[model samples]
Target: MSVDNFCETISDQINTGILVVSLDFTIVKWNRFLQVHANVTPEKVLGKCIFDVFPELPKKWFERKLSSVIQLGTQSFCSWEQRHHLFELPHTRPITTDSHFMAQNCTFLPITSDNVITHICILIEDATDVCHYQTMLNKTLESLAMANRIDGLTQIFNRKHWEECLAKEFSRARRYNHGLALIMFDLDHFKLLNDTYGHLGGDKVLVETSKTIQSLLRLCDQFGRYGGEEFAIVLPETDLVGAADVAERIRAAIEGTDINFQDQIIRTSVSVGVSIINSQDKRYEDLIQNADNALYKAKSSGRNRVCLSTELP
Candidate 1:
């Protein structure tokens, strides 16, 4: 086989775009891979200057590097990790491919004759698929993160998410010198209710309670089930008085109605503890403990009452 036929055979078998250009950046040859990748046929692109055909090619960038290749006969390679050449392609070509089609790796080799640069060989490898898969993997990880923060039963924020949310709100409140209120509460004799009725009936009460509390809350409020039969609420921009008022409203709502569980009417009440932000408290445990203390006060005084942390005196 002749040398020309061998080169054609090699070009046709390769997946990478292979092309040759003159020292002036005029296309001297374009292989079949280049034709498919570029969507430009040899007849149209041959003998044409690179910028004249793709006018958006960064003139300054190419002028700087191409001048070096021409003058110094330096063979250079560019990785997609550094910059993307996808923008250089026609908009139609980009859209026809999937979102993952942005990998662009190219090598520039200067063919020298007697220490003078005569022609340059360009090789391009398409890595768009690899990049697309990476983006999809990242999105999957994000979804997992969201799922980990949700409670399995009520599909609300779980305890871990509650802590994260409280920390962020605490920072915001301290920065703005605004009020932050925390309410802690538990069902009165939850163990008795669970024992008298089965675990399923207790679950019904918990679910209904979540709904009731959520209805009373604003969009900015954050609530989470603290533990078995216990829950907590974080209210940003609310003072201690405001927190107590909200807690009473919750207690009243719980006691005002009976939850229907398998033909039995279950009556229940909640003991609440309320606190307002006075200083920059970093950990949620301290605020939770304070609320628990107030809740203990309410439980001791009367199971259905609301107690405030500041009302300890």
Candidate 2:
């Protein structure tokens, strides 16, 4: 077979679309793949301006790319990620969802004769399956990460994740010498509620209390289930007074909220302790310990009250 026949055979047999355009953007060579996918014949498109044939094409963008290849003697590439499709080809994959056009990655190569650039060849590769797989993988990874960080019952940050956030916030506050606060709170007489209403009723109280406290806190504040019925909160850039105010608000909210369980309304209250980071604090745990101690004092003095570590003698 002749060289021309070999070239024609390769162009027709390849899966990718190939189109050759002159410097004036006139279609010079339209391969079979392009003819079938674009629903245009070579006889009709040859010697015609490509933009006129496909008016939806990004003319200015393609012109710049073509000019670069012609002037700089280099190639250009466009991925499916950057641009979905160069041509509105029919979707052939029936199993894929939310896809209408064939995703494509395109390449532009300069076609030179005797070192004088004459035409540019555009090659298009189908990338639908690859793009779909990548999107699905990303969503799966995101769901997995969320599951690991969130508490199963409370729908809030778990103890381990909350501790990680506290450590980071503590370091940031200490490094910048900014104010930070910790609040530890738990239900008063939680065992009594559990015995009276069973574990399911106790769970209802925990869930409702978590939601109430979360609604009262700021977006920057971190609230998490430390363990069992106990919870902890991290307040960045907040001083002792601000932290105490937050604790009081949460305590009031919980006391006011009535959790419904099995046709009965159960009321509960929380004891809160607030502690601010001080110059003498060595680690994040030191702040937690102070808050815990203050919480103990609140429970001893009276339930449903907020206490500050600084106020303790």
Candidate 3:
């Protein structure tokens, strides 16, 4: 066997697609992989312009890539990450994967003859599996990050996430003097209620109460589980009076809800404290402290009621 015949045998056996094009984009060579995958024989595509063979291909962008390789006499690359495929070829396993077209990572190789670039060898590799795995990995990471920001039982923002939101809202209020309010509330006599019902029942109560509160909240508002039997709400574009109104609604809503757990009915109430950002408030912690003091007052003066720091002595 001769050297040229030996090279042709190797190219045909390889799984990758190989096609050589001249400066005018005329197809000079097409390997076996390209023939099978593209469903075009060498007799049909050879000596024809690549654009005429693959009309759907990105013409202007591909010209730029080809021109650069020819001028520089260096190899260039086209990743699946940037553009999905160079040729409009069907995937090998379209039934299994989401990709309709074959995911391809292509390389533009400068075929040099005596330092003058004569042809451009385009190598196409199937990247469907790699693309699928990468997509799944990204989604998993997003789910994990989202889980960290949420409370497990209630599915609302956790304490840490809630605080982060508050800090951002507080900064906005300070900068633009936007109306912002914070409400902190805890279930009234939660320990006694837990004693009457099991821990499972308590979980039910928290979940139900959170759902009820969420229904009344705006999309911009942030609600989160503060701790055991406790929850907090940050109301954007709301003032002291507006927050008090919201707090009252929350109190009445909870007082009305009758949670059923294991065929048993459970009634619950909450003591809510509301506070709005004031000029004297230097940090978000100050808003938290004021709301906490008002919450204490609500508990002391009989639970299931709303109190406001602005209204306190």
Candidate 4:
């Protein structure tokens, strides 16, 4: 076949909108892709001003963009990311897409005559599928980031995120010289409980305990799973006395509630250690260490009780 015929064949078969416009902005050529999708034949659009044909287009911005391409004799391009579409043409997949019309990537190429620019060939490509995949990927990334912040089993803050919160609370309390407290608690005889009822029973007890503690906490409290059968809470604006009261309340609540697992009744208790920020406390870890020390005292003396850091020494 001849070169001109082959080029025409390629342009006709390719599935993208193509149009050529003269210096006066008159539509000179329209490809089959545009003919089918835009539902306007070449006979009607040819020799007609583009602005007259499509009145909804942003005339000023388009004129400026086209002027630059003509003067510089270089190609120009625009994506759907900037503005949605160059034409108000109806897209083919209306049933599936949420979009009202087609999203487009428009390219303006200078068509030269005898080494001088004369007309511009505009190519319009549908970016609907690309936009769809990008949106899905963004949602997936958001879900992953959220999962990182929460524990998979209990749905509370995970160790890393909870520690981050603790550090921030510590800074705020120290800066403002306000009150703050930390509570570290362990389920008493957890190993024995697990052995008696299997890991599944222990899991249920942990899940239920987390829910119960959450229900009792104020909005300022931050809870997290420290490790297996162990948990921690950061109570903002809480003093030593108030911290002790909070610890005791959590202890009694857990002791009172009966957890049912595998159609069998099970019971568990927590040994809690409470500590408040003091003038001598150098860092956030110091507060956690003090609470841990009190927890050891609670466990050593007896399980199912609360211990205060101030009473330790």
Candidate 5:
């Protein structure tokens, strides 16, 4: 075979798309890969202007590479991920882990004739798998972050998440002067219950109590297990009266429910203390402390009761 025949055969066999264009950005040659992948037939696309074939190709994109190759006689790469929309395709090439990639990685090399640049050859290779894998990895990481924010035992917002939310709600309340109430409640004699019931019965009470309180809360309220037997509620746009009412409702719900364990009906009750934000209060710490004081007062006075700190003058 002659050298010309071998060169032609090599060009036809290569899987990568090849396109040769002149200084004026007119197509001079289109290879077999280009014909198949780009849905362009050589008979129609050859010797045609780029803008005429694909008018959507921005002027800046063509001007940057075409002018540079003609003037500087330099070779440069054009990744399809960056210049994908230049063509008039309705959908971008879909990338998957198991499928053959359809993206393009092109190199622009100056073609010289008689010591003057006449044309440029653009070589393209597919790189779709890399993009798909990166997208999947990012989604997986986001799912993990969301899972870590939940408490394992109580299935509620963990302490870290609750503190962050508290800080954000505090700032919002301060900014808008909106009513923000914090209620701190704990299971009275929880330690004794855990000790008497061998931790299993105590676990049952905690879980059941959470469900009961959840049913009574409004959509805008946030409830989280602050610690072993203590839980906190954040009520947005609720005044002291509203907070006190909600607390009483939760107390009543828990007091009315009975936990059955091994054919024994065990009564469970919660002591709740509620406090609404006062313009006079200086910090979040004070709000929490006031609620905590009320909770202690409830425990001291009697279990199964709701007390509001804002009632104090």
Candidate 6:
């Protein structure tokens, strides 16, 4: 076979699309792959301006890219991630269900005849499969990360994740010398409710209570499930009085909200403990312990009220 026949055979057999254009953007060579994918014949496109063939093409951007390759004698690459496709080819791949057009990764090579650039060749590869797989993988990773941070029952931040948030908030408050407060609350007589209403009913109560409390908190406040039937709230830039007000509001909201379970209206109450950050406090654990102590007082004094750590005798 002659060298021309060999070159023609290679171009026709290759899966990638190849299109060569001169310095004037006129088509010099149009390979079989380009003919098949672009639905145009070499006879029709040859010697014609590329922009005229594909009027929707980004002419300025394409010109800039071609000029760089011709002037600098360097290749240029375009990934599917940045631009989905240069030419709007039909998405015929069965694997790419979500894609509307063929995703492409294109490379521009400067073709030098005798140490002088004469034409630029564009090589385009179908990247639909790779792009689809990467999108799916990213979504799966995001779902897993969200699941890890969320409590299974209440749909709130899990204890482990909430503790990490508390530590970071503590460090920020200490560094800036800003006011911060912690609130710890638990359902009053949650064990008795579980025994009376069963585990499923108890779950409904917890979910409803969490939603109610969360609705009353500010956007800056972080609320999370501390444990079974217990929750914690971190109030940034809040003093004892502000934290107490928030705790009282949450306590009232929980006490008033009724959870409907098994065709029965179940009423529940919460006892909240409020503690402001102090100079004596060393770590986030200290704030939590103080709030826990106040919560104990609230439970001892009554069942549905808020108590402050400083009030403890």
Candidate 5 lands at a TM-score of 0.66
Candidate 4 lands at a TM-score of 0.70
Off by over 4 Å in 2: 1-3
Error of 1 at 104 (Å): 4.6
Tens digits of per-residue lDDT for model 2, 1-313: 9999998999998989898899999988888888887788899999999899888789899899899999999999999998988777765685774778888999999999999999999998888888888889989999999999999999999999999999999999999999999999999999999999999999999999999889888998999999899999999999988899899999989888888899999999999999999998999999999999999999999889998999633
Please provide, for model 6 over 214-296, each residue's C-alpha lDDT reduced to its tens digit, 9 standing for 90 to 100. Answer: 88888988889998988999999998888888898888888888789989999999999999899999989999999999999
User: Which stretches of model 4 miss by more than 4 angstroms?
Assistant: 1-11, 19-30, 42-103, 107-122, 168-180, 217-221, 236-249, 310-313
The order of the candidates by lDDT, greatest first, is: 3, 4, 2, 6, 1, 5
User: For each candidate, what is the lDDT?
Assistant: 0.81, 0.91, 0.93, 0.92, 0.80, 0.91
Per-residue lDDT of 104-127 in model 5, one digit per residue for the tens?
Answer: 567888888899888889886655
Q: Which tens-of-lDDT digit does each residue in 20-95 have in candidate 4? A: 9999999999999999888888999999999998899899998999999999989999998787788987877787
Checking candidate 2 for backbone clashes, the offending pairs are none
Candidate 3 positional error at 230, Å: 0.7
TM-score of 6: 0.92
Best by TM-score: 6
Top lDDT: which candidate number?
Answer: 3
**Candidate 3 wrongly placed segments (more than 4 Å):** 71-74, 114-116
In terms of lDDT, model 3 sits at 0.93
Per-residue lDDT of model 3, residues 209-296, tens digit only: 9999999999999999999988999999998878888899999999999999989899999999999999999999999999999999
Model 5 poorest ten-residue lDDT run? 84-93
**lDDT (Cα, 0-100) at 20 in candidate 2:** 87
- Cα deviation of 211, candidate 4, in Å: 2.3
Candidate 6: list runs displaced more than 4 Å: 94-96, 311-313
